[model samples]
Target: MKWQNSLKDYQLYLKIERGLSKNSIDNYILDVKKLIDYLDANHINISPVSISSEIVQQFIYEVAKTVNSRSQSRIISGLRSFFNYLIFEDYRADNPLELIESPKIGRKLPDTLAEEEIDQIISAVDLSKPEGERNRAMLETLYGCGLRVSELINLKLSDLFFEEGFIKVTGKGDKQRFVPIVDATKNYINIYRYQIRIHTNIQSGHEDTLFLNRRGKQLTRAMVFTIIKQLVEKIGLKKKISPHTFRHSFATHLLQNNADLRSIQLMLGHESITTTEIYVHLDRQHLKGVVEKFHPRK
Candidate 1:
């Protein structure tokens, strides 16, 4: 079979069966594409079904030279999954990456902002401009609800349950979760929705989308990143902050305030409690306080 045919099938499997998001599928496909590119560049004509471990190892060797250990590990994992898919389809008898082992790397913790820093960044938004209220509301929703950028942009008007004090969020793999909404977050969002958003001549399909661009279209992921970047620059803050930084801060602040991990995990839409445990490492002081306050010896 041709490499392209196998890759197309793999992409469909990832999307239809695995239920991965477009970004995830693209990333997985990218790893296979890199191997294809390497083979074509060297004039080596071998199909995915006929490819051997040595060639795959050589491709990984080339990848390792340009990327960090974490990235290298991820590429290896992505390729492994692709080959496993081939095996599942009976295209191959054995997985080429079966014997390969990923490099040992430490779990890199996410960066978080202090409450004051978050305030400073949000306060830097220029309320004089028309998009100002929208920006502020977006940031507030991001931090307040601990939403991913994709979730924030895809938020809809119908998802808001203000009377119930919750907002339904569509998270990874299109899984839906209802997160508790604070009164402050609700007020900011209402200001944007009722005041600024009503004035926009919203496009046909994006009417239900909560946030919009100047053209009344739905906001892109890059647009959200740019908004946060400008706010960080405006405050003269040196940290390399992104839309996810607010999410990290939200989780970290909650953990510090004695909120349970299970609750935080549910609110953040994490599939596992282990993913939520990173915030525990962020607040050693909070752990210390917990030990001092509740331990039997204390």
Candidate 2:
């Protein structure tokens, strides 16, 4: 099959069978398109099915010189997945990347805020302003529930189950999970929803979106980052932070307080235990106590 046709099929497979998001599929396609561009520029005549491992390695080597280790590893993995899909479809008989290795890089621990630091950041918001209440509620919910920025902005009125003590979070790939919502978080949300959001003329196509811009539209990810950046600066915090830092802090705080890793994984909508395990490294004091209390030899 032609590479173009194969690419289209691969995209459809990722969306339908693999249930990947459009963004994810686009990234995968970009990876393959890079390979196609390289082959075309170099006047390599081999078809996708007939390409040898050496040619693929050459492409990887060229890419590695220009990209960081993380990006190079991602591109290599993307290509490996693409070729595996091709092999499954009987378009190729051999995999070119079976022997290839991903880059050796340690997991970078996520940045988290201490409870007092978070309080200071929240206190820095100008509550005298009209949007102050709304901003406070938004930040509180973000940190309290460990929500992704997307989840926070896309939250709906119907998704609020305060009486049931949970909020439904639609996570990556549209997977829905119920996260327990404490009264403190729910009360803030209710105040903003009823007092401020109720007065806005919500723009069309954003009627159901929870967070809104001053223009009554859905809040963009960039807007969320901007809010966090302003607060970080206002509080004179030296560490880098984003909306996601609230998420990391949520997980880290919970783990520090002895919340089970499995419970945190569920609440955070993490698919892998390894992802949640990063929080364990966030608190060295907690780790020392765990070893002292749990290890038989200790």
lDDT of each: 0.94, 0.89
lDDT of 2: 0.89
lDDT at 185 for candidate 2? 88
lDDT by residue (1-298, candidate 1, tens digit) is 9989999999999999999889899999999999899999999999899899999989889988999999999999999999999999999998888888898899878999999999999999999998999999999999999999999999999999999999999988888999999999999999998899999999999989999999999999999999899989888999999999999999999988889999999999999999998887754676788999999999
| Model 2 alpha-carbon drift over 4 Å, by segment | 291-298
lDDT of 2 at 86: 91
Q: Per-prediction TM-score, please?
A: 0.97, 0.94
Q: What TM-score quantifies how close candidate 1 is to the native fold?
A: 0.97
Candidate 2: Cα lDDT at 161: 88
